[model samples]
Target: MPDPTPPGPRAAILPAPVFTDPRVTLFHGDAVELLRLLPGASVDALVSDPPYGLSFNGQAWDDAAGFRESIPHVDTTAMSAPEVFEVWCTEWAAGALRALKPGAHVAAFGGARTWHRMVRGLENAGFEIRDQIAWLHTTGMPKSMDLSHAIDKHHGVQRTDRIVQTSEHDGVLGATRTVLSKGTPVTEDAARWEGWGTALRPAFEPIIIARKPLAGSIVGNVLSHGVGGLNIDGGRFADDRWPTNVALDPGQADALDMLTGTWQEGSMSRRFPIFRFEHKPAARERPRAYGVSHTTVKPLALMRWLVTLVAPVGGVVLEPFAGSGTTVEAAAGAGYQVIAIEKNADYLPLIRSRMEQ
Candidate 1:
């Protein structure tokens, strides 16, 4: 994902590191700027969580609003313009490519809505599109708008009352009546939107996985660079149960056999994970972190598993957006070295604190 634009003056590298542990080193600067300092084909893999451009809660790091929420700004969604965000992704992915050895893999967390933009940018930056791993979990918090409130504001309705749904005696569409407390009336429009809401309940997060194009054959890539190819055995489950034709309907399975003649052993393309993770613990709602806080805190168990799945033992991992240093902790715990980068200086302390933990 090299930049096409002409290069400008580079930032001066400091003489020493900001925070360093046995397995982790964090740099306080822009990811693209720091990425250029690494020699090409140096990193083994990348595990990171970049801003989803949702402008989540108007946080400064989320790029939603300028500085802070109270301060007046254009209500920008992401930290920058749409074009700028796209460029940012492309540039960083390019930078990741340069830092990563050929045939290295990248797994990045992204919002379901905007992740496609990131994926396209990565592909454009010359990474091969691998399977997108879905981290299934429950999320009760939603960003959808409340239509009832909007209707009230539009009708200039103001009152100090509570919503009371009581089974009152007769009148107004049978016994059960939904009335604003104190018998306050609601417009037909307002009543109509009481239970209606926008957007689906977000239930899953997408981890876009990709790999830098290999230098040659898979064997050559592994032999020369000790990268490329996932640790299938490490990532594989202990149970033998795996992908089968059960997912298809019985009739459909039969139809396929009738159409293409009876299938034989080894007919399937690849094995799918038989065991599914409800991720109830991870999916539960949590308060949004604000100001200097990094809202998205990936579970350590999940991060460690992902690291083991992506990188080999003692391999180097580069995390571009190392918010709170969860990646660093996971890497170090999983026996890998990590280079973490964060743009906002505020989270440096938080990252250090978490890595220490």
Candidate 2:
């Protein structure tokens, strides 16, 4: 085999002003190196949405001689998919477990393709798989498909008030866009018209919640609750029916608002601002022009939900691949100590700006 490669440098070695802050320790360097510096079992929770190993945004390799004049020296493409993922999961899981207090939990976010691999890596790092929770979102981008138009009239004239039946297409296409009014039809066509529905939008992804098992004996079977589904005791005969897919109505919004401590518009008005920020689009103009480091950045709502679940009230949370500091912001919002490590220096300022705001 070739000579073993040297490990990346730790992010903790940066200026004192960077890592000294306990509230939010934002390290602008390689996570693998930074994680090595942290004491084992030092965190209350290890929550991160690592790169999917797909080399998203093409940051895996550098083509500096091409259109782009310069590139970040650190290229992740040197390692194979399995090697990269294994290193990522193992390093963080080991450090996280070492950092956590006994019986603490870790919720890692990953795509379907590498979710199992991550779970396996965590298991190897000595973490027990607890529950695989689905972090479902209420909003997503639209998908396009080719719709075969059945021309009912051969007169080459568009029929007035004619029904255009469209089935789901795999490819993107611009057609009669869907629009929906409140309490209107929930059909595919209606959803299309209203720009609602995953068929027309991007598919919702799930988050895996795996816990580091407590050392003691079984404590009467731990009880757990599902956010979107039914309630039951540990020994009850529960049928695994498909989870009830309830849209966020006024009542659900009110309940969630209370749970998440969202500010109410008014005492009488039941509407909560939880979804308001959740649904807010990216800034029309970015603060600075930087190449896309990662696509499908995790929303703050999803990160906050995970942080609240796995981390203790004031415990430290570690994100190995702290892209854009979504986890950092969420952890700060939830009042937990956070240490975010990102290798890309260009995104460091962006993360700082967002967190400082």
Best model number under lDDT? 1
Clashes of each: 3, 17
Q: Scored by CA lDDT, what does every candidate get? A: 0.69, 0.54
- Candidate 2 lDDT by residue in tens digits, 114-214: 67767877887778787776544445545443221112222233334434444454221122334231333334444344423234443345466666666
Best by TM-score: 1
> Tens digit of lDDT per residue, candidate 1, span 194-276?
76668877756788889999999999999999989888667654365432212222223334445787554433222222223
Give the 10-residue window scoring lowest on summed lDDT in candidate 1. Answer: 242-251
Off by over 4 Å in 1: 1-15, 64-80, 163-185, 240-292
Which residue pairs does candidate 1 place in steric collision?
Answer: 1-94, 63-78, 63-79
State every prediction's TM-score relative to the real structure.
0.74, 0.57
